[model samples]
Target: MSSRLKRGIRRLCSTLSIPLLGCAPAERWEIPHFEPWVPEEFHPASIVPETKTVIVIGMPVSLPAVETSPSIWYHEEYRTVNTLLDINAYRIAAFLNAKGYPSVALPRDGYGHISVLIERPVAFFSHRHAAFLAGLGTFGVNNVLLTPRFGPRVRFTSVFTAAEIPPDPVLEDPLCIRCMRCARICPVHALPGNDYPDGLTDKRACASRSEELLRHYVSPCGFCIKVCPVGDDRKLYDRETMEIYDERKKEFNRLHRAWRHVRNYGGGERAPGMINKTPPG
Candidate 1:
């Protein structure tokens, strides 16, 4: 692809409300690092044989909203972001196709539902891996991609095309600081507190919690992302302090109260003991 067309694709992402975009050669999937880690069946070229480039786009899940996770507020925000990702990716693919480049957009989450994840947590495709290969981020101890722009609080989608767009450089430095906050704060003890591969999340436990939360209209427990201290977003939102996550802290009572109020109104009413009412610290 010409530099001008690549720039246009980026501008298109920005216009569609996507703030992060990157490209990677499809063959990056077979490199020494990813070759043994991700199976051949999952590779971009295997899925789309004409693929030459994998385009990734991401949108930040507002930290303030993520802080209220397991509540209706964060649940809606998550859905909205996923929807936009799918839409933006489809448009980008369409743009490439118009230029005579065979292109296809992949769904943000390939699973049918949270229940499906409980039985089998793996997705057909992995956007987190795609994001890392595209230079948008690196894997965290929590087993999610951690970007400098939004830490683990970002959602990603991908587009595959025959057009060989210039690929972004692979990030050489790690973004995760390994504070272990994600491991410590997990309510279900999903994260094992070790770096990626070795510390892969206990998907069954994590998915079970999400399945239960879905019954109450709030799913996808995001405590790991919420507690992560990476990202420029922390500074922008003035959330540099970890103490704010502790509800017992008197100073943050007002913030806690607001989060509680949001939780109460939407979703099925929490019975006497359906789920923990308090947000995980």
Candidate 2:
């Protein structure tokens, strides 16, 4: 792609538009790193034979909102980010198509429902993997891609285009601190605490938890990302202290109280004490 065309694509994914974004060469799939883990059918070229580049766009889930995991507030934010990622990918693909390149947008989440994941955890495409190859981020211990700006709190979608846009370099430095917070905080013990590719998530257990949460309109159960200390977002939001997530810390009760308030309504009921303790009357 011409430098001008690349600039135009960047403009489309700018903060004023689609937020975090990057590009990867379709051939990255055959690299030794991915060749062993990702199957051939999952490659961009496999899905779109004409694909020469893959554009990955991301939208972040707010830290404060995600802090209220399994709550309607975070649920809505997750949905909003996923929606924005998909919409922006579609627009970017359309832009490429208009430029005389055949392009196709991939869905943010390919599964029809959380139930499907319980049985078949893999998706038609993996945006997190695409994001990594695109130099958007590196893989975290959580098995999620961690962008410097948003950690694992961002949702991503991809656009495949026949145009050979120059690909961004993959990040060499690893992002995961390996604090083990994600594995420890997993309510279902889905995370095995091993570094990614080695300690993949227990998809069935995680999906089962998600399925239960979805019944309550709070499907994602974002405990892992919520507790993650990565991302400039923590600094931006003045939530640098991880202790704020510890409910026993009386000093952060006010924040906890606010989260509890959001969980109180607009979602299916949970069992007694299933969420935050009743706020002071």
Candidate 3:
């Protein structure tokens, strides 16, 4: 809140066209500090040399909050985010293909399948670290990815290819602190102990509780996302606080335009909605 810091934030906001209200000092939050994990002299076969390009697209998945049931939000947000991912995946695929890289799309079929399907586990890898490395956003204390645009309110999917694409650089900033707000809010006690030195979390515990919640037919609990100081703000200007907004907006627009184009183009692949249906193989 000092004049110098205020000026620095103002400069950032102005350069990015982000509004200043509801904005907090970057230092106020303990942003995730990720160590780079790239291996030297990586074998090309690990990534399947046939892929010409790889593009990882991050999408938002909603969880139920106290204000709005996580289940309802999850269903709604899942569809919206899934659509956004599909559209963006197509756009990136098209762009890369046009550039002469025979690209293919990857779906959310678990990490193993993702590695095999994309043939570039390193490029298409999943995890909080990979997400951070991709510049989608930083991590919260709960280890959930939080973007300035959506807070911890989003889920992501990636695209992998054989194309020699440049990976997106990680965003550098300390946005998350060791504050246990998110961990404290978890209804399932899935978070790690506050004093754990590694700052690592137990995913199995969290996922198990999430699954249990899903089985009960209640709204999915997004206590982690909800309690995170980052995503709690609902202000428009606050949407610009994170780096993912630009990509999210571009993906949204691309999908909207592409949907219209598909509707008009006619007689190509099945209409958007109909194309994804499973047929008995």
Q: Which of the numbered candidates is closest to the native, going by highest lDDT? A: 1
Q: Order of all candidates by TM-score, from best down to worst? A: 1, 2, 3
* TM-score of each model, in listed order: 0.95, 0.94, 0.55
The sequence of per-residue lDDT tens digits that candidate 2 reaches over residues 70-174 is 788888888888887778788888988898989999998989988788889999999889999999998888899999998888888899999988889999999
Lowest lDDT sum, 10 consecutive residues, model 3, at 20-29
- Per-model C-alpha lDDT, please? 0.86, 0.82, 0.45
Task: Report the number of the highest-TM-score candidate.
Answer: 1
Instruction: Give the Å error, residue 18, model 2.
Output: 1.9
Candidate 2 has a TM-score of 0.94
Instruction: For residue 187, give model 2's deviation from the true position in Å.
Output: 0.6
Global lDDT of model 1: 0.86
> Model 1 segments beyond 4 Å from truth?
245-254, 271-279
- Under the 3 Å rule for N, CA and C atoms, how many clashes does model 2 have? 0
Instruction: Kindly list the per-residue Cα lDDT of model 3 for residues 1-281, writing each as its tens digit.
Output: 13443343245334533321121111111233322232322212244446332334455453222223233334345556656665655655565567555665555334442224224323344434435555667766676677776677666554444454344455677566656767765655767745322465665555555454444333345666655556434453343222321354443232123322332222213333322221100
Per-residue lDDT tens digits of candidate 1, residues 82-149?
99999989999999999898999999998998888878899898999999899999999999999988
Candidate that beats the other on lDDT, 1 or 3, i.e. the better one: 1
